[model samples]
Structures are given as structure tokens and as C-alpha cells.
Target chain A: MEISKGWNARKKKQLQVIIAFTIVPLFLLILFTYYPFLEMIRYSFYNMKYIGPRKFVGWRNYVQVFTRPDIIRTLLLSLYYMVGSVVQVALALYLATIFCFKVKGENLWKGFIFFPYLINGIAIGFIFKFFYTRGFVLDTVLQVIGFDLENLPYWLKDQKINNWSLVFTSIWRYMGSNMVLFLGAMMSVDDTLYEAASLDGANKWQTFRHIILPSIKTIVTLNIILSITGSLSAFEPPYVITSGANGTGTFFVVMNDIAHTSQKVGLASAMAVFLLFVIIVAKFVQDALFKYIFRNADTDDESADVARARKKAQKAAARKAKGGA
Target chain B: MAKTTAAKVRHHYSAGTIIWEIIKYASVILCSFIAILPIVSCVITAAKTPEEYQTTNVMTPPANWLNFSNYLEAFKTANMGTAFRNSLIILVFVLLGSIIIGTQLAYVLNRFKFPGNALIRNMFTFAALLPGIAMQVVVYEIMTNLHLVNTMYGYIIMMCGTDVMSIYIYIQYFENLPVSLDESAFMDGASYFRIFYSILLPLLKPAIVTNLILKGVGVYNEYYCANLYLQDKRALCTVATSLYTFTGPLGSQYNMICAGVIMSLLPALIVFIALQNQIYSGVAAGAVKG
Candidate 1:
């Protein structure tokens, strides 16, 4: 009883020490990371295009984004990118399932499938550019099918098809990461469950649908969120592939326009703010649904406040002994 | 006993054999080939003569292949050397600074209950959720104001905004850990810095190493920020930007671009492969602790 009381007193001391060092840095995080976010919100209310903004306009920027044809076209292009990403993720899921079984040099196949993902988008963009420009790709195939080589449309040249080409490369880059995530989820299923299903005379499709699908539901949500967020924030390849002139792939081309070319800092900030809100609100909605319901299948809740308090107590006790001396 | 033993061995064999046989080696081989075709296309294109490259289909084998000078041209023509150096410089410091700053910030945030604890948590969460494009806007403004635009420090500073993944990863791992180890250190009269450096940092190695790889990978691969903030041809060019010189309004160099890409890609590729095990068991494979 005496020892327990002493331990408790010492733990309290350690917690005190951790809090002392933590104060200034935490303030800085709030100042820089969070404060700018608030500034983003405030900036959204104005046409603060050149930093010297005194006029107050309410919701007009968002109104312009929604009603304007150019912005709408950009939004649809962004949606097109999402569709391409979804298809890529589905393709990855299909391929990962195919690779789940035993095979010769299984590791090699997995590595190969995942290779495109690790390459820099600029490099991939350059390679795809080479294929599109003077050599054979879709254009080559088109030529074989009787289109003239000299007048062949750049595979990524057309505004209509540029988004597709960009998204295909995006998928190529990210599908491996998706596959690995889902594959990890797949590997977690207990062998006993499959054995029991086999004993019950389940066919391959039935076993897959009944066992595999149910097991990966939580992971599917995670992947969906990743895909949605990834598409919305898409850049790099399109920047390299399109070089931003065609205005084909993402609405975020506005961001580059505002920054590097046009120098419309305020307009860029407005676009950025809108994009941020869309992502955060969407993620929060998913997160809320996730915890209220998806929390049923998967468990990961102990790392919040209780964890913070526990670590603080541990550090406080270490500072006291030297102070006593 | 022999009959039972034989039956048990048979049971294990029967379970996976049919399932494995359905997909088998051929399907796997074909998928693998399809997967490698793009990279293979890139490699082949790099080796082909410019004249041959212009006329031949990339998917088709070249009639003649040789030491393509386009790569030599890529370096001389694309200004790749300066870009490569700038990328290297940013890669070194951004990786170093982000780890140092982010981990120390995380350590404090995860370990303390300071006055603005809720605000701090919200700040980290907000930054994580900050629209990548939107954040770039504010960062551009800030970088410009600080005169950091086109500078290496700008890249490193802009990178300081990070997701909650590292903190939460540390928090989760730390939560699972028994606090007995820290207690011994505490009983020895160590300061917070001592406790953090000697004990907590070591304890959080698995998470630290994982976050290091994850954070560094994306930042190093970052395209949008670099493209936006830097304009000085020498200042802005990383391997990413250098690769862009291969692309233009005019015809792109076919095979040499691929060689340059392979050169840039090989480091991250090697790291991913080498760290695959650590990466899997690290933050990626595990479920995020709430």
C-alpha cells in the first residue's frame, strides 16, 4: 500500500515535466498550421486577388466557381479523374485477388505490378510524353487501324482524352499502393474460416463473396477515402503530361496558374480554400459514419486522450530525483 | 498413429491445392508480364535510335538498338545536372528537418497536456486534412513574404505542415507500450530532453522509422509545390523538374527520357523494396489506432 502511494506521487511529477517542454511548440503548431487554415476561411469571403483587399464579398467566389462555365468544366475534369482513379483501384483490387494464390516467383510479379507506383510522376510523364509524341501508343495503334501517322492526334493532346491519359498514369502510379493495402487486409483472414467454408461445400466464388468480401469491408472504406482524396488533390503527372496549357486534367491547374503564371495569389487562395473545404467536409462525413458504424468491425480507439495523459505522467517522475539533489 | 498422421498431412494439402491450381502459374506470369510491359516499353524506347524511335512503335521491337545519345542530350540539353543538385539539396534538408521538427513536435504533443492541448491536436488534424492545393496557396503566400520562394529553405519550410499519421502512429505505439521503462528513467532524475532523447525516441523507433520513410517519400516526390513556388531554372529543377525538360511543345526524346526516369526512380524503388518488410509491419500494414 505504501509503495503504490509512492509510485502514484512520482508519476504525477513526471507528467508535470512533459507539459513544460510541450507548451511553446504546441503553440507554434496552432499558430502556423491552424492559424493559416483560419486565414484560408477568411480569405474565401473576399476577392482578395492581390493582397490589398478591403472589400467584403460574401459567397460570391464560390458562386463564381459553381456558375462559371470554365470552372464547371474544370470540376467535371476533376470528376473524370476520380472516375479513372476508381477504375484503377477496382483494377488493382482485381489484380491483387488474382495474385493471392501461390505462383512461381510470386514476389517478382508483385514487385513488377508495384513498379510504376514508385517512379517519379515527372519521369513517368516524360516517358508517356515520348510514347505520345513521335512514337507509337494509341496513335500507333490508330495508324495500324488506318489513321495517318503525321496527323495522328497526340494521345494526351486532346483536352477530352488528356484527362484519361493522365488518370491512367495516375492509376498506374497508385494502384500498387492500393493493392498492397487491400492485400494486407486479405492476408489477415484466418485460415480456419476458409477451412470451415470449404468443409461446408462452398464454391470459390461463394467463398470469396462470403468470406473475403466481408473481411475487407473496413479496408474498402479506407481505400475509398484514399481514392477520393487522391483524385481531388491530383497533380504532378498532369502538370508534366499536359504542362497546364491544355487545361485538361484538374481544377487545381488554377493553383499553378495563380502561383507561377498569372500571379493571382488571392484568386488561387479562394480556389484552394474551396478545395480544402470540400475535402475536409467530405472526409469528416466519412469519418463520422465510420466511427458510428464501421467502428463495429474494426477497433482502433485507445490512442487518443488517455494515451496522452499516460505519457505525461511517465516523464514527470524522471525529472524529480535530480531536482532533490 | 500412422493413418492419423497421414490423414492430417492430406488435409493440409487438400485445402489449398485446388484453390491454388485454379489461378496457377500461367495467369500469374501473364499478369506479371502485362505489369512490366510499360517499364519494359520505357527501357526499350531509351535504347532505340532517334530515327528508329521516330518511326517505330514503342511496343514493337526496334530493328536496331544502340547506345542512345538522347540521354547524353537529355543531360546537356535538359539542364538535368543543376536540377539534380537542387533536388539533392532539398531531399537532404527537407528529409532531415521534417524528421527533426515533426518528430520532436509529435513527441511533445503526444506526451504532454499543455494549456492548448486541444488546439494543438486540432492543428495537427487540420493540417493533415488541409487541401493539398489550398495549403499550397497559403504556403506560397507565406514563402513569398519570407523571401523563401525559389530557395531550398522554402521547400523545407513548406514541408513542415504534416499529417496526424506520425503523431498518431507514435501515440498508438506509445499507448501499447508498458510505461515501466520510462519509470526507471524518471526515477533516475532525467530531464524531459533526456527522457525524450534517451528513452522515448528509442522506444518509438518502429514508428519513427516508418514515419521517416512515409513523410520523406511523399515530400521528395512532391511535384505541385516545387512547380508552383520555384521559377529560377536552376533553383526549381529537382529530378522531377529536370525530367520535365524532356517534355515540350516540340517532339519529346523517346528512349533517353526512359533512361533518365529509370535513373531517378531507382533510388526510391530500391528503398521501397529493401524496406518492404519494415514498411508492411510499420504504419502501413497495421490499423490506425484511434
Candidate 2:
């Protein structure tokens, strides 16, 4: 009877702890995140500013989101960022490949490159503003290299060059972090594969293609998908540096403008919902395709690359065992 | 023949290999230079006076490296004291709140096989996929309705909104931890809170560090929502929005702006330089796991 009473007390205490620990976080999530998101969906269907009465406009907000030429044009801005993300990923991969090899001052190089990722986005906006100002940092650097300043395009003013300038900053800011990730993934690849590949007279390209690529394929695919979403959500560089001037206003900036500046809360919410929908669709499709490919890919257990890696690892282990013996 | 070739390839420093190695090193160094150049230029520009800035080229070194007057003026005009204070308050509270809330929620979710555990987990996963920035429109409205707009408590509450990443990190950490510890403790008549605080929470150090670095950096550098929610410039200016004080009427004061920028960059730079390994590995782990 005493043991039963003690067990009951323990159970009650456990229940108390669980409820106490969980209740606040759950409340905060419901209040701040989920509730607001649901409101976003509801607001998307209404015709209301931040204030005053709302009319239930049904699909009108969504129609406007789809039909408006200006709104449609804003989305094309994502193309610039999309192109930028591709280049960023490519550059990151290249750098990662180089850094993975024996390089002088590799740590310093990694630190320098990754430093920008740590800087406040607002500070970067200011720094780049100074850097891209005419006859300033970029121009001065070019002139020092014997390039005539007169021939240089205005970095922030010329529409043709401005987007590229913004894209370059994005690339600069992100490339290092991505490289660090790629490098980490690459480091996990067994070293014996490289040794064996070299023994088979495989050149650098062939070694990378056969050995490095397969090991890091998961991370590479993940980066690509993330890059797509990142491109869609590009905001900081444009918002801070140029305030989305000179045709730099991407989708998010436009939505921000609608909500804050124009006071069209309902329309902005619709835009938000639309963007969210696109992102969800993109995520869904990527997940589905990845699931399909990964499912099939797993079935190919006897693939040559896997076989080589396995054999190389086994050989290394065997050598270690022999040495120990 | 294979042994001979392998040995030959290992031993020989061919001209082609030498050239390729040089090119690889050169490319890495060149990119590093590109990365550092703008900041180097900013440093140079920040050192110069207004007269020096107007007369000399941007890349020119200052006459006196000790001229800290611009930094002082930037600090004063930007009211960065308040900014730093506000930012610290926000960071401390947000980090504390996230760690507590995230670990607790993770604990319950991981330990219990409740009716809605899977549902809750899926809900967070779905929330992670939602473009959070896009929902800012409605979030702002929610804040307005709650009278949370332009309030510090509101901002802190919002910032502490359960981070999906931190929760996942904790949950992942918990999964790796053996449940026998808890079972044994329970048998010893320890309360659930005691089991958590004494046994499980201490084991969560590494996960906590990872979450801290990732979430701490994010909250520190977060500008958009901070600017939107905390509209009172003097009272609520964060380290992020404080620098924008120069972006308006003082826009042409490049000298002062550069000073402000450098001041802002200093803390992050110091942290990175001091704890390079911890930061780098933490970041890498977070990225890979996420």
C-alpha cells in the first residue's frame, strides 16, 4: 500500500513537470507563429488595410496577385537571384574543392572568406554601398590594376551592372559558409578512395568525379534545393544597400513595400500567401523528386563508385589490422 | 606496372603538376583577397577624417591612425549606447527563453508518447517550410492587435517564439541519449524535473552550444523585424538598426558611417578570432544537421 502510494506520487510529479515545461512554449508558438500564419491566410481573402472594416473579397486578392503586370514583373527579379545562387553554389563548390586539397594558409583563407557571413546584414549594406559608390572601392581597385576608371560602369547606378553587383555581394556573403559545409562533407569522404584512384592513374577530375562527388551528393543536392528557396526569399542585400532601387526590388521587397508603405495589409498578405504557396510547391516537388531518386539510388547497391569506396575502406582497415597484428 | 606508376606519380613533381598547384593556390589566395578587400577598404576609409575623406582617395591611409574622433561622433550621433544595451537585453532574454522553451518542449516530445506528439512534430516541420518572412504581414498585424508593437517585452516574446531548428537539435540530441539514465533515476524516486535538470540537461551541453551559436548570431544580426517592431529609434535601436542612423540625414558622412560599421563588426570579429574552432564546427554541424 505504501509502495503504491509512492508510485502514484511519482506519476503525479511527472505529469506536473511535463505540463509545466510544455505549456509556455506551446502557448507562445500558438500565439506568435501558428495563429499569425492562419491570420495571413484569412487576411489574404479579405480586402482590408491594416485598419478599418474588411470586405470578404474571396479570390480577388489572389487574382490581383496573379494578374497584375507589376506584381508579375517583381517575380522576374527572382531570376537574377536564381542565377546568382547558381553561381554562388558553383563558386562555393570550386573553393571547397581547392580548400580540401593541401593549400597554404587554408585556415586563414577559410576565415577571411567566411567572415562576411558573420557581419550584420545592415553593416554589409553600408559597406557595399561604400564599395560600389562610383570612383570608390571597386573602381579604385580596378584603377590600381591599370584599368582606366573612365571605362568602368557605375556600380550601383547602371541597371545592367547593378543587379550583377548585388548578385556578387550575395555570392560573396554566402559562398564561404556553403564552402565550409561542402568542405565538411568532403572531409567525411574516406581518404583511401583518393589514394586508390591515384594508383589507378586517375587524374584530379576523374578522382573528383568518381570519388568525391558520390560521397557529397546528398549535401550537394540539399544545397541546390536550399539555394532555390534562398533565391525566392532574397531580401537583405537589396533592401539595405539600394532600398530596392535600380530594378533591384525582388519579390520580398515588393511585398514589404505593399504592406508597410502602401498600407495594403490584405494585398500584402495575399502576396505573402502566394509566395508561401510557391515555396511550398517547390519544396514539395523537390522532396518528391529526391525521394524518388534516393529510393532508386539506394537499390543500386552494386554501383561502381560505392564498390570502389567500400573496397578502398576495407583495404585500409585490413592494412590497419595487419599493422596492429 | 601499377605499383611502379603509383610510386612514380607520388614521387615525381612534374612541371605540369607544379603549374597546376600554383594555379590552385593563386585562385584561393585571389578569392580570399576579394573577400577581405572591401573590409580592408572600409577600415582605411574609417580611419580618415572628413577633410581627408573628401580630398584623398578612399583607399588612402589616414594621416593619423589614432584619430578616434569619428568613432566617438558615430557612437554619439547614432546613440549606439542605447542600441547596444537594447540589443544585449534582447539577446540575453531571447537566448535564455529559446534554450529553456526549446529544451523543455523537446524533452516532453522526446520522453512522452502522447496522443499528439507526432502531430506536434509534423506541425513544427511544416512551420519550418513556411516562408516565415512572407508571413510578416500578418505577424505585424498580430503584434499591432496585441499592443505589442514598439514594445521591448513584445519583441522579446516574439523573438523567443519556438525556434524549429533549436527544437530539432535538442530532439536529435535527446534521441542519441540513452533512456536508461532517466529510467534508473525514476526508479530512485527522482522527480521528472530532477531527472531533467540533474541528468539530461547537463548532457545537453554540446547541443546547447550549437543552438546558442546559431540562434544567437541570428538574433543579433536580425534587422527587419527588429526595425519593424521596435520603432522608437532612441529607445529600441538594436546593434543592427543603430547603424542605419547614419543612413538618413548623415548619409553623406562616409567617415562616420564606416566607423559605425567597423564598431559593429568588431564584436563578431573578436568572437570568430577567439573561438574559431568552436564557431566553425558549430556552424558546420548546424548546417549539415539542418
Predictions' DockQ, in order: 0.39, 0.54
Clashing residue pairs, candidate 1? A13-A316, A14-A315, A14-A316, A14-A317, A15-A312, A15-A316, A300-B290, A318-B186, B45-B255, B46-B255
Q: What TM-scores do the predictions have?
A: 0.81, 0.92
Query: What DockQ would you assign to candidate 2?
Result: 0.54
Q: In candidate 2, what are the lDDT values of residues A1-325, reduced to their tens digit? A: 9999987786677678778987897787778778888999998889888778999999998999888776887788788888988888888888888776666678899999999999999999999999999889999989998999889998988988888899899999989898888887777665756666666555556556655676677788878888887787888889988988878888888888888888778888898888778878888888897798788564323466766666566556655654686
Q: Each candidate's lDDT (Cα)? A: 0.65, 0.83
Docking class of 2: medium
Given the true complex, what DockQ would model 1 score?
Answer: 0.39
Fraction of the reference Cα-Cα interface contacts (below 8 Å) that each candidate reproduces: 0.44, 0.68
- For model 2, what is the error of residue A185's alpha carbon versus the real structure, in angstroms, after optimal superposition? 1.2
Per-prediction count of colliding residue pairs? 10, 0
| Off by more than 4 A, model 1 | A1-32, A51-55, A138-154, A158-160, A195-202, A244-247, A258-260, A291-325, B1-31, B60-68, B79-85, B249-251, B280-283, B286-290
